[model samples]
Target: MEDRKLTVRSVERALDILLCFTRNDDLGLTEIAVQIGLHKSTVHRLLSTLEERGFVIRDAATEKYRLGMKIWELSTHLSRSDDPAILLLPAMERVRDHLGETVSLYLREGKERLRIQAVQSNQAIRRVAQVGARLPLYVGASSKVLVAFASTEEQEALLNDPEWPSWIDRVSYMEQLYEIRECGYAMSFEEREPGAAAISVPIANCHGVVTAALSVSGPVNRLSIDTLYEYAPYLMEAAHDMGLMIQ
Candidate 1:
């Protein structure tokens, strides 16, 4: 009766055991088996494997099981540039309210960039970015930040890609990356879309790797250097908070 084509039973049962502990701080072997409608022996076997891998930890005194730091470690890496919309959407909404501009979360894909998340301004007319919108990594505030923090090999390959001419010469590009690294952000003014401007800050993981970018964008008149600089701290703070949530 099981749908073997679409599901793997052992993995499903293991996940079930994991989910049981979510509602209860810790669960005994019998309780987990009861919760998942599985036999005690089966649940114990699954927990043995999980505990061995550090996915779950068993209390020495009580023998009850709880999620482990391994879960946190895996979750940290799982918070990719495009995923974790639940955390990113609300954070970006806060940024939009503070800056009165559209806030976007961008991720890199090969030589291109994608706006995976966004919160648009309430104004009748404001800069807007549809989720999953693609842009060139060589332009735009978010794109530049993603590129500036990209892995060296990725940066090299993108810089040399022939689909588009280099945005800047290698010497200047390197210098710009250094500047962005020092400043902890990047900005663009009417560089991509006419009359639009944006500023972006990097979101780094606990490992200090830049994984995503948070950007505020609007009409050039409103998103000026002064305004963007003013919101830079808030943007950076939001990015940091979001990063911590991943860990």
Candidate 2:
């Protein structure tokens, strides 16, 4: 019984070490030890074991640790199995076909939003969304929609984060978030990539919790702000359908 308890405790500590990477992309041995309240020796042992399993990786030059490909592999598996991204592909495809642009589904991952699913446009000149892409949560329309509909505590945390670009107008951005909450959607022009434009709507689950952002994106020439507005109703309809699939 004592051996079993010790094994469980070790497992719990290892999980704590993995969770620490969610906040920061990388950490040194001592930083991880300090964060998890473990001695450096204990942390080192656990990290070595994790590294051996490809659950974590160490940077030889920086001597820092970050999550490894195995985590992504496991997540990919999870995303494939009854996940919202998989379930919402048809809706995304319909929106893409209707708008003649790329349609994508984004989910928040800590300080970033991840493109989990996408259907590309047939246009020769169009924006392309890569699945498994991560973008900051402060720029694009999908990012804004995800952050705008998040919990109040999360909003405050993001608003106060020091890593935001100096060019951002905080006051106006806050107001935009408020408008997004009121208007039910968001739009961005060249915020992340020049000549790129997108409009996004929040996708809420059956319990009214916003879980994802449904977006249509294309070249600025074809998807101006006005054009994006015209496409909003279709995006909203698809988002509503996706929401129903969540529960």
Candidate 3:
């Protein structure tokens, strides 16, 4: 027998479910059900209702579900509402267009990394990441850029966890942070994923606190270390401009 039962389905639960969608760009029925800890049938029914209400939709081509146009339209109204992505997108677009690669905006959530926005190039071989994707702290160039700026206490805290990712050690991450600060940008070659390379520049608030980062990524073949060095100045320029714009 179930020891406890939910007496009512409140609006808060629905909203919490909606918020989960913001952590991931797309999810299938089973994935959503598992994440929300609900029965598959219940999740399916809720998703159908959400789809009818225009909060979500299923992509026939990929058979995956994602937030719908309505969400995007509604989100646009709040785009500038205390979120850096609003001010970052325009500058990000300029860099993306100039570099012909994928651009992303990232923010730190506690010790994790969150994607605030992403724009994939129209080019055939463009790299892409879901807008709401969350990744471990040591996953990629942008994530490491943010992590490198984290406080020593925070770094120590993460280091104490035995489950931390394999590639990042606290001492090494700290060293890399100093180098990134000295150079004004971060670059990595296939560190996070095979064949993916990226360059990142930190975004700061008016107080000069690092709040977010802007990055451009592409296949390693196309964005070699030498070329990434060549592109570093542009990324720094864009991040600086966007930070001022956000302020």
lDDT agreement with native, every candidate:
0.84, 0.90, 0.80
Clash counts for all predictions: 0, 0, 0
Output the lDDT of residue 122, model 3. 72
Per lDDT, the best of the predicted structures is 2
User: Which residue segments of model 2 deviate by more than 4 Å?
Assistant: 1-81
What digit string (tens of lDDT, one per residue) describes model 1 on residues 139-162? Answer: 788888998898898888877778
**Clashes by residue pair, model 3:** none
Best by TM-score: 3
Per residue, candidate 3 scores C-alpha lDDT tens digits across 121-210 of 878987887887888776688877887777878777776777786666667777887888788888888877788999998888777788
The TM-scores, one per candidate, come to 0.65, 0.72, 0.76
Q: How close is candidate 3 to the true structure, as a TM-score?
A: 0.76
Q: After superposition, how far is residue 182 of candidate 1 from its true place, in Å?
A: 0.6
Error of 3 at 28 (Å): 6.3
Mark the 10 consecutive residues where model 1 has the least summed lDDT. Answer: 79-88
Clashing pairs in 1: none
Sort by lDDT, best first: what order? Answer: 2, 1, 3
